[model samples]
Structure formats: C-alpha cells, structure tokens
Target: MAALTASQAPGVGLGGHDGKGADAAGDASPGDGSYDMELPPLESPNPPGGSAPGGVGDKSGIPKSVLAAYKKAAKSLATSTPGCGLRWELLAGIGKVESGHARGGAVDKEGTTLRPILGPVLNGAGFANIKDTDGGRWDGDTTYDRAVGPMQFIPSTWARWGADGNGDGRKDPNNVHDAALAAGKYLCADGRDLSAKADLDRAILSYNNSSEYLRTVLAWFEFYRKGTHAVPDSDIPPVSVPGLGEPGGGPVKGTPERGGKDGGKDDSATKPGKGSGGSRGNGDKEDGKDGGKGGGHDKPSPEPTAPHALERATDQNITAVAGETFAARPGVRAETAKGKSVKGVKVRFEIRGSTQATFEGGAKEATVTTGADGVATAPALAAGAKTGTFTIRATAVGKNLGTVDFKATVTAPQADKVTRTETTALVADKNGTFADIAVKATRKGKPLAGTTLTATLADTAKGPFFSVDQQGKQVRTPVTVETGPDGVARLSGLRADDKPGTYTLTLTAEGGAKVEVQLTIKG
Candidate 1:
C-alpha cells in the first residue's frame, strides 16, 4: 500500500487551462513531452478528492484524443461492473497513476521500481512466462511479481479473485474494463465495504499489500466524499416556530385539556407561567423543596454507591427564538452526583461532520458555549435556509460530561410581500376584510387578459412547485380562474383543504408572458 500526502501547492491559476491537466501554474515543458504538475500529498492510493485528471486526474499535457480515449475507457469500466462497490472514477485515477493510460499488453517486467506499471503480468501469475520472453527471470520476492493490471491487482490473488468485471467473455487483465472490475471487486470483497473506514482500510491494504496503501486510500476517500455533492442540510421546508405564530404570543389561553393520543396541550398550558415549578429541586420534594412528593429523588434506598459511576445531568430542554442567533442555547448542563444543578461547572464543546476533513471555503462551523442563564446557543443561522441538524456535546473540565442534540426547523414568519406571501397573510386581518380581490395579468405594465392561471399547493416546498409533472401525486382539486376583458383574472373559493406552505399561482398571459407567485397557507 502507498501513502500519498496531500499536496501543499497553492491554487492553480490556469485561465487557459480549460480543465486540461496541463501546466496551469506556469510550469510547462518546451515540446519535451513533459509537464510539471503539483498535487496534494498522496497519502492514499485513492486520489485526494474523488475527482482525478481527465474526469479522474489532471492530464493537460495529454492531447484531447487521449483524454477522449480515457473517458471512453472509464465509461466502459463503470458500465461493466455496476455491482462493484468501487467507483469507476477512482479506478480511472488508479489507471492514470499506474500506466499513464497505456493499454498495450503486458511488458515482461520485475522488481518494485516497475511494479505499478507491469502489474498485469505479475499479478496474473504469468509473469514468469512473460519475463522469460523478455529475457529475464522472476526473483519471486520482488514488488514486480505482486503488481496487478491497470488498477494494480496482485497476480496470485487476482488469479483466484480476478473476475470478468465487464462480462465481455475475456477476462483480459490488461483491459481497463477487466482491470477496473478486478480492482472494484478487490476493494469491496468479503469483509470489505468502502462505507466503513476500517473495512476500507483493510481493502486498501489488499490492493497493494502494504499498510501505507490503506492510509492513502482513507485520505483519498475523505477528500472525495467532501468534494462530491451530498445531501444538503437545508432541504427541509421552514415551519412557523411553535408558540410564536399568532398575535399576543400566539393562540390565547384556553381550557387545559389532558393531552391525549392526538394533539398535546397547547403552548399556554405548558408554558412557564405562575406557580410552575422553577426551583432547582423541581425533580423531587426532598430537603423540603417544592416538587411532586417522592419524585424518585426523595429516596435512593436501593442504590449502590460506585466511585466510577458518573451522575446523570438533567438540563435537556432549552428555548430559542427563530431568526435569532442560536448561541444562547447552553452546550452543557451542570449537575452533581445527587442530580442537583451545579453552577460554574466548566465544559468544552466541539462538532464534526464529513466536511471537516478537507479545506472548506469560509463555511462557518457550528459552535456551542454556555451563557449567563446556563444555556448554550447556536450560531446565528442564515435566512431562507430550510434544514439543519446539530449536536451539542459537552465535556466537563474533568471526566464527567454529557451531550444534547438539536435540529432547526425554520418556520417563515408571516410577512407581506407584493409577489409571494402565505394565504394566511391575505385573510389574517380579522378587524378588516377586503372584498373580491382582482388578479390581473400585465406585460410591460399593461393589462393583458384571456390568460390561464393555475394554482398549486406546496406539497413539500419544491414538491408543490413541480407537482404538475408529478402525475397522480398532486391533489385532484383544480383552482378556478375567471378572466375579464381587461386581462383581469379573478379566483375565489380557495379552500383550506389545500396543502399548507407555499402554493404557486402560475399566470400565463395571452402573449405567452408568464409569472408565478407563491402563497403560503396555515392551518
């Protein structure tokens, strides 16, 4: 296994590079058939980022004809072994690294110096014959005998494990399709799954028969995973923050109904109002404190005393206002062995994700810290963001610590907009009612009627926007539209049965002018 360190080269400035793996950084050979290139350290056999030159790695010096050939090779390899866990792009990177895209049949070779290039003959167990043809005999212990084909598979292992990856009847080790399949199989073989770091490390070791290979592969995997597109955290739609949507701190106080299997008690019922438990001993009535009698803390009759056992921290729930910085949320809860709140207990916070491994372009990492109220708050998030999930872990200055998880759900507050507004915004004024609103289509500020306006309820944000193409998924109800001669369209009887969130009203004018306004509705 080979361990390649990340390259420390600065950003390459290649205005004319145009995706070519050439001397983008002002280092080019004068028709010497060579070019200088800088790379991040090669700590792993896999490229640092999932991307390599020429759709796999940099190949600027190589002519476009060569790049086309390599791309064609990559496509064939990828399509051949859809079942293989290894990506063709990674395999292509290995090909570019091992043989310089050379597809000629195996050249008789031996020794570690040329092992990566002559991998096919060595790993295929036919090295002795090829070596004999080349007027050389195998030393049997050299790195040359261990090398495989384009992606470098060892012959002894490949002979038993090599597969017809492309299923083209010929298990040609020299062929990119076969070699890539073999590499994929070798990487994802039994007890080797790329998803797990340990398994991926093990698979990397098998590829080149070295621990260094495992390390390099891990580094490359990290780089690739980060560089590729991943599921975004903001895909979820914004919802109104609980207990803050209505006037006067939301819904007015109502009768306290016992929470049932359906909806729970309203905000006012559970709010921290007068006579609510606010003492530190709210978990119990011990020491003459004000809490439910014998609330589990009063008596610890059967408990065993263990010096190594850590006490459980109790502060779990925290509140934050929407659109405000989340830094007020406490990262840690102070507590004692008796479950009592411990003030001034110091704790540290940290966060992690797949993005942390590589260099990020100024993206802020989430931070957690305690405040005067013993609460930790998250950073101020951006607007229009729909999704976020975060975990706040706390470590006591000593060994005892705890963790809390939080997810952000954005509920866009009620706002009036000339173009887009929720339905509630239209009918929200209980004291004032506007009659028969007229919707008119205009082009260049002139009324143009006889147009069609289709209204659709937002299913799940983007879901509603594209629902017209969703076939049966969209609701069967239709939004009625009436057009007047002055290009005025009147729509009425919009019912509450329509899905909440953003509903788009698409207007298509007679002259093909079109516009869409999103309306949000609340239940």
Candidate 2:
C-alpha cells in the first residue's frame, strides 16, 4: 500500500476561507507534522447498504443517484479488498462534508454534477498560495488555483487518485460517481484498515488536515450508518473578519469563488475556512506565502466504554398453534459491569429454525434501537406454515456486547372438529329476536372446554346479531363465546330487520376448527 505522498501540491481549502490571514506557504508537503500521525480503528465495520437493518428506502436525504454512486464504489472496493470492509456511509460522510453530496450543482443521469464546484483561490490572504500547477488546462488559472468536484480534489491530488467509477472511459472530477470512487481509493491508501477507529481517523485527516473536519465527517457518517438523513449545513462562503479583510473582500483575479474560471486547471480544492465563522484553514502552503493556520490535526475523543456487558431478556418463551402469531417477549438490555443501564445501543433480532417465521409489522428483519430504559422489543413472531420449533436470537452491534437466544414452539392441533347444531328457520320480526344457534368443539373425540369461539355474520345490514349480557347491552357483529364443560357455544338473540334475506354465520374456535352455516329469515 502506498502512503499518501508528502510532496504533493498544496491542498484545495478543506473549510471556509476568509482570505483575512496571510497565505499559508504552498507545497508544505502532504501529511507533514501534526497532520502526519496515524489513526486508530473502531471495533466494527459500518457496511454500505442503502438503509439500516429493517429499514427501507432512501432515508439519508442524499439524492438517489449520489447515494447509489457511493454504494457502488464501496462495493467495488470491498470486493477487491476482501477484509478492507470499506463502506458507503464513510464515503457519504466525506461527500456531505466536502460538497453537500454535490448539492452545489445539477447532477445528470450520468452522475455528473452539471455545475463545477470550486473553492477559494489559495492566495496568501487566508489560504495556501499554490502557483497554478495545471497550466490553465483544468482550472484556467495560470497563477493560483482552486479545488473542484463533489469531493473537492485539487488537480494534483485528483491526478494521483482519480478513478473511473461509472465504467466510463475517462476519470472526470465533475462526475460524482468517479469522484466518490477516487475519494475512497485515496482514503484506503497506505493499506489503512478502516475497521479500526485509528485508521479511519487517520484516513479522514489525510483528506483535509482538520480535526473539526474529521469530527463533522464522522458525525455524518454515523447518521448515515443509522439510515438517517443528515443534511449538511449551507455552503455560504465565510465572511471575512472585519480587521482581517482582503483587498476587495472578493476572490483574486484568476481564482473564481464557485468554480474554475477556465477549464485549463482543476478546481478540486476544499473550501478555505470553517463554515460561517471562517475560523479554520486547510493547513498546507506553497513557495513563500504565509503559512495559514491549518485546522489542528488532533486525535479524536476516546470511544465510550460500557460499564457492563449487554444482555438479552425475555418475559416468556413463545408457544402458539401452527399458522398463528406468537408474540416473542425478547428484549435487549445493555448495562455497565455495575448493572447500570446502557441506553441507545442497537439490537438486532434474527430467527433460526427448521420452520420460518415472519416478523410482525411487515419488517423483513427486526431491529430496534435501545431507549433510555436500555431495552428494545422484537416484533411479534408468526409461526411458519408447518408446525415446528424455531429459535430467535438477539445480538448487539459490537462483539463486546453479549448475545441471547430464545426458543419458540409451534404445534398443530390433532383431531379438532367444530360441529354446528341443527336449528329451525329464523324469522325477521318487529322485536328482532331470532332462533337459537349453537356449535360444539372437540379434540380427539373429547369435548374441548374453555375454548373461545367467535361468530361473524357474512351480511351485517340485513340481519344484525345483537347479544344482551347481564347489563342488557346489545353487542354487534363478531360475537364471542367461550365453550362450556360440554364444549358447547350457543348464540341467541340474533335480530333481522323487516327486510328479509339469507345470511351466513362463520364460527371459529380457538386452536380447533372453523364452521359456517346458512340461515334464512322471512319477513
């Protein structure tokens, strides 16, 4: 793996540039001094799928075309470097920070940003003074140059890392897909393993020698990884500080504010200073320009440690008849070693067994984010078409958190039958009471007591069944009754209006059988 070259040209500004301070020296050597440190690694890989687990559609607020480009580049890199685990979220983070995922211009079907994105001119006033290296070929400036594209690559840097992400013949910085892939390649250089936090940080720093820049990028990265849309702040050019103002408070003669003046030079440098405040700089310089105050390359804060290992708890194992829904009580809880709750952790639920189970709520897979109570509930589990036992497993995001498994049993009833009682024809009278109807449930030729039975009338308008309880209140359709000691459930007080019609009643016994009967009511 090639280490990022230190002799590279001056960086395109990484943040807002106020042009108030003297220009940082150009050609300060990439990855020099404070920007020269190696990064540590995080524990897990943030994979590059469109949505978070169990989430669907585009939720990152990024344009579908741009997001697709990042995903493609990530997949290509990951496929090529088996263990690299490069993910699209990281690329998205960089894109968001660099250029709002190419929000500065119109992106066409070819994933090209119709408008060229350029940063401030690296004149001594506030940014590094880069004597134009592209010879007015890409940026059109024979003097100083600017950054370009969605990822904001200076011509020199893009030259070393430009890639063809869209399968097109040429590498174009204006094309988002190509720019994103090039950015990924640049980050993954030096054989840096992103799975570790240190390496990820180092890679991001190399992109733009700024600690704040790294933080902003990582924050967006986390949001993207969670399948949440995170809109980058507006790209208003930083206001020049009052006393530190430039000659005209505008860009120099050759360098343009928004894009390259001519196509001769590549305007791929980053924004000059930090946003709004215009406090930070990109930190590199060239020739004799005053070295701008680069954003400090400081190590990020340490990762938070849980006091205790994560654990899974369930109220009870699930038991249901085949084809019925069994609500799983699985709940994930994280704690410190001292038994304190660890909130905000993500827990994922997976089903495993000979029989398949569908997660309730139409989720392809169930995942929940832990709340303040440190618990996430799995959706209801529906048994497979055939009866059998299955296992539900709950796992935390990181390996440090433990895992738990729960078993569920689904059984098919044997010898269950529902029989309807023979009854005379019912009449629709002014008073509305009809003839009595009854049904019996049995399992293995024996009465099935304590079974709940439900009855529904096919046509509710013509003959509405109303049952009066001890309170004499009328209960409408879907009348429910429980089987007695003899396994008999009876229905009475069925009413029909003066308009006579035929009606069908459906009877269903819990865990038993279903039967429907036809009845005629005459006016």
Candidate 3:
C-alpha cells in the first residue's frame, strides 16, 4: 500500500533532532508538541510520476499520498465548517515543517506513515511536560508523552481532536489523513477563519506557539499556494538546501541563488528542517546538474512551463432533483499549449447562482489541485431543498486560460398532500358553471406550485361536469389544471346536465394526494 517500495524508503523518523529541541517562548503546550520535531529531509530526484497523489509546484515534491491527505482534510472541513476556509496549502505548510511530509512522503498509499513519528519526551526538560495520556498507546512511553504522528499531535491533544478521516474506523495519529484532519479541526476550532491573517497566525501559533515555527510554516504555506506539481515519492536524492550550508564546505548543490522566485524559495528568515523538519532541495535546476555524485552526472535542463488551458472533462450541463445529489460531478483538465497534460495547476470548482446546493460537507466552493493526469474533479454536489438553475464554474488559478461552466438545473419536488383552500362548499352556477374553488398542493407546509391537479366528479351521469376549455364547448367529467404561484389550482366551470343533486368532486395532485370537495346543486 505504500507509494514507493519499502526497501528504497528510508526511516527518517518524525521531525525531531534527538528530541532535544525546546520551545524558546516557554508558553503553555502549543497543541501536540513537547519539543520541536526535526523536519523531514527532501531527497526526491526528478523521477517519473506515479498514479497516487502527487504534485509539487514545478517539481517532484511532497509524497503523493501525503499531499492527498492534506487536501482531503481541507475538503472535509469545507463541508463540516465552511466558515473555516481551511486551505490545503496551510496544512501542507505545517506538514513541511512538522515531519518533512512524513520524511518526504515515505507513506503508504492510504496516507499512513511507514514509521511512528515520535518527538522528545515532554518531561519539562526544555519542552512542555505532558505526561502520558494514552498509556503509551501512541508514543510508546508510559512515563511521559512525546509528540507522535506526522502532524505531531501529543496523546492528550490527539484524544480530543482525533478524527476518522480515512473512514477506516480508527483514529491514528500515525496516519497522515487522520493527523491532517485532527490538525485541521484544531486550527478551525472556535469558528476562526484561517483566511484572515490574524486568525491564521493564531492558529499556527497554537500548533507550535513559536515565532520561528510560525515563520517556517508560513513560508511553506505561501510557497504551496503559489503552485505545485506531482513528483515521484521515491528515495530522496542528495541535494543542498539554502541556509543549511554544505557539510563538506563544498559549493551549495542548488544551482539557483537563494531568495529567488523559482527554486530558492523566499523562506529565508528561519532555516527549515533544523530540529524537527528537514530542508527540501532548493534550486531551479532539474535533477542533478551541479556535479554531485560524479562527473558527467549532469542531466539536461528542465523543460520550460508551457501555457496551459482548461478543458471540460465532465458533462457541460448537469441536472439534479431537489434534495438529491447531482447526477454527475464536474471535472476539468489542465493541458499545456501543446495539448500535453500539465500537473500542479490549481483548479477551483465553485457553485454559484440562485441555489442552496452544496458540495460534500455543505461547501459551495472547493479548490482541488491537479494530479498527475492533469485532472481535477470536484466533490459530489448535493441539491438542497431550494430548486433552480445554478452554475458550477471551474477556473485554473494563475493561468490565463478561460473557465468552463457547467449548467446545473434542479427541478421542483413532488407534492405530498393536496388540500382544498376553501373547505366550505362549492355552489353550482345556474349559467352552466360552478363557483370557482381552489385546491392547493403542498409538501410539509411548503407550497408546491406548478403542480397539475385533476378534478373528477364521482357520479358523472348525474353530477356536474368540468369545462375543459374557455368556450365551455369541450366538457368532461375529469379536467386537469395546473397550480398557480400559490400552489392552488383553480377549479371552475362545473356544468350539470339539467339535473340537481349533491355530488362529490375528487381532486388529485402529485405525490398520491387526493382530496374530496362537496358540490351542492338545486333544480
């Protein structure tokens, strides 16, 4: 179930530098950390892509499974708490600084880390003293509790914020999906919107409560938001990261200068992967070009990113019934100018117009990153009680490519009961017609307008007949009339065959609704 083979994957452990890192601020337990965990090392070379979750901004970064977990967590919150506005990039930033994405995506296909990521023991020794809460269940320590899992949730904190993200019926901090969700819920608690700068900072600080940690995570977060591409979750390669000078005092492996837009990411203030997180490769050059392993080890330069265009992958026009799921989900593809699939483009699927329809988790808008296939499909959409036409627009972020719009139509619901507006009596007119009476169709008190109702006289031989037309020339025992905006269908033009007697008129509408109105005639 692992994204990469086990033999090739190394055991980097969780982010921690021998569990000796300390929180300089000396504040309360941030969230799930006793001591700062060492960042995972970035070692993936320019390898071929895989089918599982994969993508980085123009490079092979973040294991496919690990990336998927972050996105899934954010998507889950979008529905459970739309006000949170949790973005996958935010979670990714933290993950980058936490365990270097499970030591650079050394995770199984199900987003479970191959190893149990544990931090230093929290015995009040240069770290928060959090005693064992899980009885050594998570951290394998009975005396003290150390941060565990890819997101580094302490046992006590995990107990409260733990979530079943993968639907595996288990809440495991070692699983990236579970940890990402637990982390996301914690960040979104108290109705805080991460989109706001203040709230965003607060949430990050609550996780580690360190200004340096916050800055490191924010750097990664901002970089991810810019864009990413799917890289193979293979063994990490030997490359130099900016600020973490070469071990042999050799020139930095990265060909590009630091603090630039391309590879030398602008996360310059705090050196990443110091204690708990490890540094990813920082360079614009592809694979190996700085002559690392041996001479002639240089490879060709990376291809220039071509312009991309958005194409509709799913039905252009979709439909649904009120209070039902949409038949088909809207999907889009990002293709290069030469029609080749492009990876790492951010595609935003938005629900707009006059409808209360929401994607899974009650979210109207969701952003999905393009996977290896350059495809992004939105979450399942559900039409709420309100019915009308709406639009699902898919647009590629940072791309000049135009958007694709999916026209969604939600039809009216069936009526449950048909009742008479005036239950008193229907008086027959001497002028070959009956006084106008109305029957309404409703579903749980909500008016169901535009419903068709048929009126039929019980005894057609002697009772009044209905005028099917305005001229009264076309008459019949049963006539059909559609309800108006008030959900009431007007019944009129009841003519008798020169006979006077009390009769019953049966009105039937949608949803097996049948009502009887008494009609009295005197001759």
Among all candidates shown, the one with the greatest lDDT:
3
Provide the lDDT at 452 for model 1: 59
lDDT of 1 at 314: 32
Residues forming the 10-long window of minimal summed lDDT in candidate 1:
28-37
The positional error of residue 130 in candidate 3, measured at the CA in angstroms, is: 1.2
RMSD (Cα, Å) of model 3: 18.9
* lDDT ranking from best candidate downward: 3, 2, 1
lDDT of each: 0.33, 0.57, 0.63
Write candidate 1's Cα lDDT for 51-142 as tens digits: 42323442222222222333454455446544434543444334434443332211111101111122222222211211211111111222
Ranked by TM-score from best down, the candidates are: 3, 2, 1
Best of the two (1, 2) by lDDT: 2
Residue 137 of model 2, lDDT score: 29
Model 3 whole-model lDDT (C-alpha atoms): 0.63
Q: Worst 10-residue stretch by lDDT in candidate 2?
A: 240-249
TM-score of 2: 0.36
In each prediction, how many residue pairs overlap at the backbone (N, C-alpha, C within less than 3 A)?
Answer: 50, 53, 29
Please list the residue runs of candidate 1 whose C-alpha ends up more than 4 Å from where it truly belongs after superposition: 1-85, 100-148, 220-523
